[model samples]
Target: MAATYKAPLRDIRFVLHDVLDVSRISRLPGYEDATPDIFDAVLEEAAKMCENELFPLNRPGDEEGCTFENGVVRTPRGFKEAYATFIEGGWTALATHPEYGGQGLPKTLNFVVEEMICSANLAFGMYPGLSAGAYNAIAAHASDELKARYLPKLSDGTWSGTMCLTEPHCGTDLGLIRTKAVPADDGSFRITGTKIFISAGEHDLTENIIHLVLAKLPDAPEGTRGISLFLVPKFIPDANGAPAERNGVACGAIEHKMGIKASATCVLNFDDAVGWMVGKPHRGLQAMFTMMNVARLAVGMQGLGIGEAAYQGAVAYALDRTSGRALTGTKYPDRSADPIVVHPDVRRNLMTMRALNEGARALSYWIGTEIDVSHHHPDPAVRQEADDLVQLMTPIIKAFLTDLGFDNANRGVQIYGGHGYIREHGMEQYVRDARITQLYEGTNGIQAMDLVGRKLSAGMGRLLRRFFHPADAYIAAKKSDPALKELIGPFAKAFQRLQQATAGLAQKAMANPDEAGAAASPYLRMFALVALAFMWAKMAEVATVKIAAGEDVDFHQRKLKTARFFMEQVLPEHLAAFAVAMAGAKTVMAMADDEF
Candidate 1:
């Protein structure tokens, strides 16, 4: 099997520097040290760690997977070592707050590192990924005592974490949870329940595992309002805060999954485990959202990661694998058959992958920097704007990027033809791996619903304003640029369609909520396409100005080409999406109840 991965450092830098200008993030109080030189140095080191330490282990990890026996779960070979190297390099503490012993780098840099890690080994990334989410939840909601005890360990990677939200029967519907937490004598609670699909649930990468669990209190009301968050460690800390007595939270079994096999997905049984409450009682979902929102963004990076890897693999195979000559003529007359790169169809797949990957990277990286801005900006209004942007883009990033991730992975397999179907070239694995991303962090359908139902209407459309205002300004600014007519024209028109769809859906949704539900998916796609169009137009603008200035000519030229592809070929899909979204609920609900 020839599954391969290389961190796209140049593209990452382009997004960080040229597109988003992350120096704006560094201007915030805590991120002053996040200079371009520091970013390059950190990214270069991260690329090395990903390429050398982790990428080689990806195939082997997939092959070996994880093993479970006698209440112990062991990660595949090299994972423990790779993880040691990861934490020893302070990778675990990259974006954590300095109060918790982290270096407290801006999340912009951390997001880039995260993408590289996912590209290298997604399974390996999960171990720390979950821990980071747990850290966020705890930092925001946990008591000072709990934070003092747990935050340092989680930040230092001496311990890892998991978000145990799902059970056998309930996942998205947290209101139906059966997990119960009883008040204990020692001011803690007893968490007794079974949680399934728990990623990194029982991995052996770290000394101790902390589980941020969702369970209902004895006196709590029914439904989601009754839910409470608990911190249940796999090993209870001793008086000195080291792993001591075993906690009742044990891995009953691990799930056999389609992908990310090396990342242990466990069926955990908490047998009256002593745990402490986090946040206010009956406010678990609010606190957990702190984790879920960040996880959603991180999952978007997973999609980007897979897309980049799959695209790279397809490009590699296309360049190496000889096939029929070009339709026009043979460019390489000496060879009996030209490489597949000479073919138009092959170029289409390659171009789609490249254009989407680059555009998505630019968009995601922009939001990543905004995360830093939202948290650290001195001005209240600027912070609010950044936060609004993050909220609005979260679902789009999660759903749109993952959809492309799966699409591009399949495209890789398509490009490989027969070789792709089998395990030999590893294109098949990309498909399998990409599949899970859309399913988790809320299904893309659910994401679309969140966009239409929640984010669309939140703060009286303030979230929508965050995206709409800048887009309005950009289109107005560039619509008249004759040199940019090819790029900006397509983007401006598509963006108009998006605005129309937005208003139409909001009006229809006000009349009947089901109209929103019916149009949610297409509306999200329309919004996403327009968003990407905006990014492409911005990139095209930069490429145009930079090319005219004779700076980084090759990179700018390639950027212009990809931007043109996105604007001309890709952004137009919003028209069809807009058509579908505006048609509205009646036809969709016409066949209901017992038609089947």
Candidate 2:
């Protein structure tokens, strides 16, 4: 057996089938046919592909990595063949529209499957993950002719896709991007610029690369308003969707980085490359945002997937590797030493990892279901509510989940102690891989600013209105439940604290501009913990009710214990953040810039 990944099928099923209630999702318009059986089948297939095809390459891929010579980038060995298997398996279009040769599975299911792939091999997973985002942008905003030409091939995985937004001078600040788009005699435009840190920009996995580029039109509005998006391919496809002449797009060089070695992060050069407009000229940022949101959420999943794998590897090692003897008595006297799992501290670390991983799973999938409703719900108001909820939580998902992911990876390494630092042990790799999550996809700092500055004040907190109202009602309802009664006090206090924190930011930022920036990161983290605790409480409540009915007492008991661990260990960090946020800007930015 080649160290297979189990898919966390039980937990995923509990989330999809029980906790989220997929039936309600099926009632939505496009997802009406997303039955339980269909979801299971999708997960099963995804599990096999990730475990068999991708996992085998993870270690070797890290060692071999992507090779570049004279502007040609070659993916790790077996990647092309594995990618072919992935394409043939229809793993690329799980959530795309059926009209575009997709299966149209719910986004929630895709989220589950993605977690597995990233866990098995994040390096390889980036290829399709980026492609999915490109496909979404083109499908949603491209012209009819553009859609007819590209969507089928993308949906079918005949060609891979890339999003080229970051430039050397500008990453988080897109307003400063200098990529220029010049209109030509034909309907197409000539794109000329240098884009850096483009994941999956140029690789041999597919016949051609479809780059969704961000550039500015001449005489257009300044800053972000002037930005326009274009679809530039390595080999410009003919009218019949076949690769024609080679376009002017070239890889200046591929970046050599800390993690995700199998993924080719290239600095792309578009020298008068022919490209077609994706959406309206001035509204290119809008189209790019659609892709960015999808990418952000998916990147959050990368954090989540790596954390899950790290935790599992840690737990397995803890159980099997015996060291110290039991303090009370030898539970395993027959052995030379007691299992590390016997120690309370070991248990605490394991519980922390398990609890955080499970809570994140619930939270991520909950957000995924929200995405489903936002896109599929028949009622516009309901859809808007879902959309607002997704927007509010997306930053949190990207920030908080990734932050904890880094923590868990560190803790996983701590669990192995000395062995963890060694490359072959693989624990350290998870930590290295997880470090990038905080920096990219609009750095965690940027995400927090969006959450506190842009999202909160936008509608006078109307976006959070949908989230807070139901949470308040749910906490009130849970007060009467017996198994969940113990959690009520902490949960209620946390919710109240969240409410106060929201109000405090509104008040402080009104006076000091720096207050929000100072508290932005901590505030987003606190918000994420509170929101995740909220989701865990819901899952705990469901587990309690089910356990009382004598339905899988073991699983429910584990769920309750994990919820307890979260409430005990993870929930209190928010209090420290709240204290910091309450300290105001003087505490953070008081020192002069030259003080250093």
> Which numbered prediction scores highest in TM-score against the true structure?
1
lDDT of 2 by residue, 1-596 (tens): 02224568899899888888877878888776888888888888888888788988888898888999988999989999999999998988788788889999888888889899988999998998888999999988998888888887888888889999899988888989999999999989999999999999989999988999999999779889999999998998777679999999999898889988899999999999999999998889999999999888998998889888888888888888798888898889889998888988888888888888888889899999999999988899989999999999899999888887788889888888888888887888888888888888899999999999899986888898878999899987778877687777687888898899889999989988799999898888888888888878988888988998999999989999888888988799889988887788885787889996
C-alpha lDDT values of all predictions = 0.91, 0.87
**Where in model 1 is the C-alpha error above 4 Å?**
none
Please identify model 2 stretches exceeding 4 Å from their true place.
Answer: 1-4
Model 2 deviation from the true structure expressed as Cα RMSD, one decimal place = 1.4
Report the number of the highest-lDDT candidate: 1
Error of 2 at 197 (Å): 0.2
TM-score, every prediction = 0.99, 0.98
Give the per-residue Cα lDDT of candidate 1 at 74: 98
Error of 1 at 272 (Å): 0.7
After the best TM-score superposition of candidate 1, give how far the Cα of residue 319 lies from its true spot, in angstroms.
0.7
